[model samples]
Target chain A: MAEIVLEGITKRYPDGALAVQDFNLTIADGEFVILVGPSGCGKSTTLNMIAGLEDITEGTLRIDGQVVNDRAPKDRDIAMVFQSYALYPHMNVRDNMGFALRLAKADKAVINAKVEEAARILDLTQHLDRKPANLSGGQRQRVAMGRAIVRDPKAFLMDEPLSNLDAKLRVQMRTQIAALQRRLGTTTVYVTHDQVEAMTLGDRVVVMRGGVVQQVGTPQELYDEPVNLFVAGFIGSPGMNFLAATLEQGSLRTSLGDLPLEDRVRRRLEGRDVPRDLIVGIRPEDFEDAALVDERHTGHTCSATVDVRESVGSDVYVHFTEEGGPAGTAELAELAADSGRADTGMQGHRIVARLSPATRAAEGSPLDLWLDASRIHVFDPATGINLTHPER
Target chain B: MMSHRNRTLTGWGVVNVLVVLYALFPVWWIVALSFKDPSTLSDGNFVPRKWTWENYHGIFQTSEFTRALINSIGIAVIATTIAVVLGTMAAYAVARLRFPGKRLLIGMSLLIAMFPPISLVSPLFNIERVLGIFDTWVGLIIPYMTFSLPLAIYTLSAFFREIPWDLEKAAKVDGATPWQAFRLVIAPLAAPGVFTTGILVFIFCWNDFLFAISLTSTTAARTVPAAIAFFTGSSQFQQPTGSIAAAAVVITVPIVIFVLLFQRRIVAGLTAGAVKG
Candidate 1:
C-alpha cells in the first residue's frame, strides 16, 4: 500500500566495486515491479538496498513520500521473502507466520487469527503445527509467503523466492503469488533472473545490466520495442534472433536475403548518421513457413537448410545457420557469455523461427521461410542501440 | 561354517565388547571398592568379597566431604553458565562480523586451549593469593572458565556458521531488533551447541585436580577430586581407600548423568553443521 522511490541509488563496496550505479525508479502505489537480469547484474543488490540489508552508497529511498535512507528494515515496515525461504527452522508453521506480530507483542488471539488466515490463504492450514524441515519445498515456500502476508506490511521484497522450487511448483506458486498480490494490493518489488517470471509477474519490469539500468517499461513494451540489443535478447524465451547485415541502396543485405526496408523504417534510418553495417533483430514468431504463408501478404523470403526442428505441440521451432557470421557486437558477445552460449564454437549465425506446427519443415532439409519485415528491428552494430526504435 | 557377513559381524561384535569392557572395567572396580568393607579393600576379587554401605555413610557423615561436594557443584555450574554465555556471544561475533584481527583472535583462543594447564597452575596460584581469592570459589571458577571458554567458542562458532545468514535478515525484516532477532530466533536454534558446550565445560571444571588441589589450601574451594586426596581413615595408620573410592564414585555420577541426559544432543551437535539439510 506504499509507493517506493529510489533516487539515484548507488551501492559501492569497501573494495571500490560498484555493485549498483545510480539506480532510479519510482514504483507507484501497490504496483508489482520486477528487477530482472542475469547473475551478478546488481538486481539483488538493488533489492537489498531497498530492504535496508545493504547500505546505500549515494541515494535517497523514499517510502510513502518519507525519506528512509537511514531507516532500519524493521522500522521501514517491509517484509522480505528470501531465496532460501529462511523459515525459522526451530518454529513450527504457526509461530513462523506469527513471528512479526509476536515480536510486536500483539495479542495472542489476534496473532493466532492472522496466522490462521494467512495459512488458509497459502493453503497451509493443514501444516500449521509442522516445522519447516517436515514440509516439502513448495510448502516451505508457501510458509515464507505466509510469513510475509501475516504481517500486513507496507511492502514486500522477494529475492528469487521461487527459485528453489521444482519447475511445476514454481509456476504454480508464481500464479498464486500473482493472485495474492492482486488481492492484497501491497507494493511489491521482486528480484529474479528469470525473464519469464519478470514478464508475467510484474506490472513494470526494470531490466538491469552491469550495475546500470537498461530499460524500465511494461513487459509488452520491452518485447515489442526493446531499448537496446540486450533487452531484446533477454526478454523472450527462445530470444530474438540477430543477423548481421550490410545496408545497401536502402535495402539491408543479410544472409537471409536482401530485405527492402519499409517506408516507416527507412524514415527512421534517414538522416541519423546510420552505420552501414547493421544488426537486424527478428522475433522467432515473426518468421513463418513460406508454404503456410498466404500469397496475398508478400514479405521478404529466404531458404536455408534447417539444422534442427523441435515441435512443442503449439508451434514448431526450426533452427538454421545463415552463411553470414553472428551479429558480432560487444553487447551481443556479453549477452552470449551471460547465457553460457559463447564458447559453443558453432560457426555462422544461427537463427530460430517459430512456425506453425502444420509446416513440414524437417532437419537437414532446405525450407523456405517468410519474414515479417515490418516486425524486424534494425540496430547499429557498433552501439548495440536499436536504430528503428530509437525513442524509448 | 560362518558366512562372510556373519564372520564380519562377529568380529565387530567382539571388538565392541572389548571396547565396552576396557572403558567400563575401571568404573565397575571403583563401585566395587566403594562397597567393600574397610578390611577387604585390597582383596584380589573383582567384586567386593563383602559389601557394605559403611564407606558411603562414612563419606557423607564428614563435613569436609559434604562441603567439598557443594563447592564442586557450585563452582562447575557457575563457571559453565558464564563461559557458555560469553562464548556464545564471542563465537557469534567471530562467525558473522568483519572486524580486524578476527583471525588473530581465533588463533589466540586456540593457542590458549592447547596450552598446558599445569604450567599456569603455580603462576595462577600466586596471582590468586595476591588478589585475595586464592582459597575461594572464585579462584577455582576463574581457571575453569579460562580453560573452557575457548572450547565453547570453537564448538558454538561451527554451529553459528552453519545457520543461514538470511535468517537474521529475515528476522530484521520481520520487525525484530538485532537483539530480539538473536534471542528469539538465533539463540533457540543454537540450543544444541550451547548444551553440548555447557556439559563439556561442567565436566572439565568438575574433574580438575591440578589447579584445584594446588590453589586451594582449605575446604573453602576444595572440589571432590582434590578433597579425595586428603581423606583419612578412622585410625592413624589406616589407609582411606574406601572413602576415596566413595568420593570418586560420587563425583563421577554428575558427569555420567549429564552425558546420559544429553547423549543424543551431543552427537547431533558434533555433526550437525557438517552438511546442509
Candidate 2:
C-alpha cells in the first residue's frame, strides 16, 4: 500500500568492500518487485537496507514520498518474513501472529480478531495454541506469513521465505503467497536466489551481480531479451547455452555451421564498429526436435551427439556436446562460479535442448536439433553487451 | 559372541553400581549417624542399632544453628538473584554486542573462576574487618556473588549464542521497539539459561566454607557448613559428632531436592535448545 523509492543507494563495509552500490529503483504502489541474484550478489543486503535492518551508508530511501533514511525498522511500518521463519519459539501461533498488534498497543479484542482472521486465511486455525517448535516447517512458514498479514503494515519484505520448505511444500506456499499478495494488494519486495521463484512471483524483476544492478524488466522481457551475458545465463533453468562465434560478412561463423544473421540483427550490426568475436545465446526452449519441426520452419539446424536424455512428464531435455570450446568470458566464468558449476574445471560445457516429449533422441547418438534463428541472441564478446539488443 | 555381549553388559553394570556406591556412601553414613542414639554413637557401624531423633531436635533447639541456617538461606538467595541478573546482561552483551575489551573481560572472568579461593581468604579477612562489614550477611554475599558471576556468565552466554537472533530483527520489523523485542522475544528464550545459572550460583553460595568461617567471628553471618565446624556438645568434654551429622543431612536435603526437580531443564539448558535439534 506504499510506494518505495531508493535513490542512489549504496552500502560499503568498513573494509572497503562494497556490498551494494548505487542501487536505485522505484517500486510502484502495490507492485511486487523481486531482487534476484546469486549468492553474495547483495540482493538480501539491499532488502535489509530497505527494511532498515541494515543502515544505508549512502543515498536516500523514501517511502510514500517521505525520506526514511533515519527511521528505525519499527518506525518504518514494514513487516519482514525471514527465511528461517523467525517465529518466537516461546509463543504459540496466536501470540506470534498478534505480536505486532500487541506491540502497537492495539486493543486486545482487535488483536484477537485480526489474528483469528489471519489464522483462517493461512489454514492455521487449528495450530493457534501450538508453539513454533511443535509445528511442521510449512506450518511455521504460514505463521511467519500470518505475522506479516495481521500487522497490515505499509509494505511486506520477504527474504527467501519459502527456501527452507521441502520442494513440494515450497511450490504450494509459493502459489499461496502470490495469491495472498494479489488479494491484499500490498507493496512487496522479495529477495531470492532462485530464478524460478523470481520469475513467477515478481511483477518486475531486478537482476543483480557483484553488488550492481544488471537489468530490470519483467520475467518474459528478461527471458526474451537479457541485456548481457550474466542475465542470459542466470535467468533460466538449465540456463541459456552459450557458444563462441565470429561475426563475418552477411553470415555468422559458429562451431555448428555458417548461418545468416536475422534481418534485425544484421541491420543493427551495419555501419557499426562491432567486434568480430561474438557469443551466441540460445535458450533451451529455442531448440526443438528436428523431426517435430516442419521443413518450411526449420531455418537452422545443428547436429550433436546426445549425452543424456531426461523426460520430465511434460517435455524431454536432450543434453548434448557440440564440437566447440565453451564461451570464454569473465561474465560466464563468474556465473559458473556463482552456481558452483566451476568446481570441476576440466569438464567442457553442456548444451541442453528442450524437445517435445515425442523426441526419440537417444543417448550417445547423433541428433538433429532445429534452432529458431530469430530467437538467438548475439553478444559482443569483449564487452558482454547484447549486440542485437532491441533497445540499442 | 552372545557370551561376549553378556560379559560387556555385566562389566558396565558393575562399573555403574560402583559409581553409585562411591557417590552415595558418605551421604548414607551421615544420615545413619544422624539417627544413631547418643549411647551407641561411638559404634562406627554402617547401620545404627537403635535410631533416635534426639540429634535433630537438639540442633533445631539451639539458636546458633537456627540463626546460621537463616543467614545461609538469606545470603545465598540474595547473592544468586543479583549474580544471575548481572550475569544475564553481561552474557547477552558478550554474545551479541561488539565492544572493546570484550575478550579481556571473558579472559579475566575465566581466570577468576580458576583462582584458588584460599589465597584470597587472608586478604579478604583483613579488608572486611577494616570495612566494618565483617560478621554480617553482606560480607558473605559479596564474595559469593563475585565468585559465582563468572560461572553464570559463561553458562548463560553459551545459551544466548544458541538463540536465533533473527527473531529479534523479525520482532523489530513487526513493529516492536528494541526494548520490546528483548522483553518479549529475547528474555523468554533466555529464561532456562538464567534459571540454571541461578541454581548453580545458589549452590556455590550455600556450600561456601573458607570465607564464611574466616570472615565471620560469630553465628551472625556464619552459614551451615561453617557453623557445623563450631558445633559443641552439651558437656565441655563431649563430642559434637551427632549434631554435626544431623546438620549435614539437613543442609543436603534442599540441594538434592532442587537437582531432582530441575534435572531435565538443567540438562536442556546446558545443551542449548536453539535450533530444531
Candidate 3:
C-alpha cells in the first residue's frame, strides 16, 4: 500500500484553460478516496496526474513520500482499471491477466500461478481461454479487475470502471469492488460522476465542482454537514431542498413558514450585521408526516398540494411546488445545471419530502408536512456559505 | 401474387448468371486457348475445337518466360514487404497522433494515389536511365513500391482507427514500455490489416504493365506482363497468339491461389469487428 499526496497539483492546458487548480490532498495508506463531480470538472484529470498519465502543470505529486511528477506510468508501479475495461481483445482472459508479469520477465510458473489465483478469486477460472468478445459485459469487467489484481501494484487507480455496465450489474460490481479493495487493502483513487458510487465506495469522498474541491470528508460527514450550497445539494438523493428566506428579528421567514432560529444560530448572528436574504436548506428526511411527529417536539408546519406521490415500500416521497423563487445563487445554478434541472423555465422550485409510508398522501391533494426546523440550514444568499454550519 | 414474386426471382437469377458469365468468360477463354492445338489456333470459337498441351509446353521451354516469372515474384514480394512495413508505421501515426502537418501528409498521399501512372512513365524512364538503373530489377521495384505505399497506408490507417485507443493505456498501466506495448499488444491486433494490405500491394505490383514496359528494354528485368508482349512465334510471319495466351494463363495461377488461400482473412480484415457497440 502507498500513501499519495498531491500538493498544489494543477493542470493547465496549452490553450490557457485551467482544468484543475491547487488540488491538495493526502491519501493515507489503504484509504479509498473518491474524486467525484459532473463531466469536465477535471476529476479524471486529477486521477491521471496521480497515475502519471497526465503531466502536472505546476505542483508536486508524491507517492509513498517520493516526488514522482516525471516518472512514467509503468515506473510508478500503479495499476489502473479504465472505464472501458480496456481488455486486450486478441488475448484470452489468462493471457490478459498475466501480461504484466510477462512484461516484467517473471517466470512462466509464477505467471501462471498468479493468473490462475486471480482468475479463481474473480470467479473467472472457468473462462480462462475465452476472448473478451465472447464474454458477457459483467464477465469482461471481472477480467479487467483480475488483470489489475494480478499485477499487485503499489496502488490502484480506477476511472469509473463500473460505468459501462447495466444498472443491475453496476450495483453487483460496486459491492465486489469494495470488498476486493478491503481484502487487498490497497490505496485506491477512484474517479466517478455518480454520487451514489461516491457515497457507497469511498472511505472519504472528495466532492469537486468546476475543478475545485468543495469538501473532503467521510460520506456520512458530507451528507449530514455539507459546507455550502453546492455540496448540500449534490450529496444526497432527491437532493437537499432549497428555499429563499428572509431573516427578521430572531426568526427566519421562508415560504414553508417561519422557523425560530436555534440558540446556536442566534448566538452566531448576535452582534453582527446579518444579511437579510438567506437560503434555507432542508434534507428530505428532515420532514415528517404531521400526524407521525412526536407531540413533545415542536415542528415547523407547511401546507401544499402534492404534485406527485411515490410509495417506495420503505417510505413515501411527496413532491410539491413552492414559491421559494429557486434559491438564486451561483452555486445553486451550477448544481442545478449539473443535475440537468436548469433552464426548463420551471415555474417555481420543487421540494421533495420523505414521510411515513402510512401517510394518506395523494396527488392533487393538500398535505400537511412537518419539518424539523432545528435541523434546517441557513446560508448567506450571495456567497452560498452555510451561515449555520458549526465548523464554519 | 406468389407466382409474380417467383417470376421476379427468376428474372434476378437470370441477370446474376449473365453477369457472372460476363466477368469470367474472358478468363475461361484464355485458359481454353492455352490448351488449343496449333492446327486449330485460328478457330475463333467460344469452345476450343481441339485441346492439346503443345502451347503450355512451348512457353515452358523458353528460359525467357521462366526468368520473367522469377522477376515478377521477386520484385512484387520485395516491394510489398517494404511498402507494408513503411505503411504500417505511417498509418499508425496518421490514425493516432496529432501533429502540425498530419493533414498535409494525408493529402499528399491521396494526390499520389490518384496521379496517372502513365504520365510518370516518360520522366521515370529518363531518370532511371541517367541513374544507370534502367532495365534493372531495382528500377522496377522502386516505382512499384512508391505507387503502392499510398494504398497500403490508406487501408491500414482506416483499420488502425477502429482499434480502441484505451488498450494502449491499459498496457502502460500493466507495466509495459512503449515498445513492448506495441510488440505484444498493438502489433498482434494489427496483423490482419497488415496482411490484407500486403496482398493488395503485391497484386498491384504484379499486374503493373505501364511501368514494366516503359522502364525495361529486355528480358534482363522484364516482368510477366512485359515478357508476354515480347513473345514471338517460330517464324517472323506467324502469330504468337497461342504462346501469349499460354503465358497469360501461367502468370494468373499464383494470384488465383493467393486469393483462394487468404479469402477468409481478407474478408475478416475488411469487416473486422474489433470493438463492440
Q: What TM-score does each of the candidates earn?
A: 0.97, 0.96, 0.96
- TM-score computed on alpha carbons, candidate 3: 0.96
Question: What are the candidates' individual DockQ scores?
Answer: 0.50, 0.48, 0.51
lDDT of candidate 2 over A133-252, digit per residue (tens): 778888888999999999888899999998988899999999999999999999999999999999999999999999999999999999988999999999999899998888777677
Model 2 CA RMSD to the hidden true structure, in angstroms: 2.0
**lDDT (C-alpha, whole model) for all candidates:** 0.90, 0.89, 0.88
What is the lDDT for A99 in model 1?
Answer: 93
Sort all candidates by TM-score, best to worst.
1, 2, 3
RMSD of 1: 2.0
Off by over 4 Å in 2: A270-272, A295-298, A343-346, B268-277
Question: A1-68 in candidate 1: lDDT tens per residue?
Answer: 79999999999999999999999999999999999999999999999998999889998999989999
Show the colliding residue pairs in model 1. none
Candidate 2 on B1-277: residue-level lDDT in tens? 9999999999999999999999999989999999999889989899999989999999999898999999999999999999999998999999999899999999999999999999999899899989999999999889899999999999999888888878888988988888788788897888878888888998999898888889999888999999999999999898999999999999998888887887777666432322232
Docking class of 3: medium
User: Which has the better TM-score: candidate 1, or candidate 2?
Assistant: 1
Point out the higher-scoring one by DockQ: 1 or 2: 1
Task: Name the top TM-score candidate.
Answer: 1
Rate residue A47 of model 2 by lDDT.
Answer: 94
Candidate 1's C-alpha runs over 4 A off are A295-298, A343-348, A390-392, B268-277
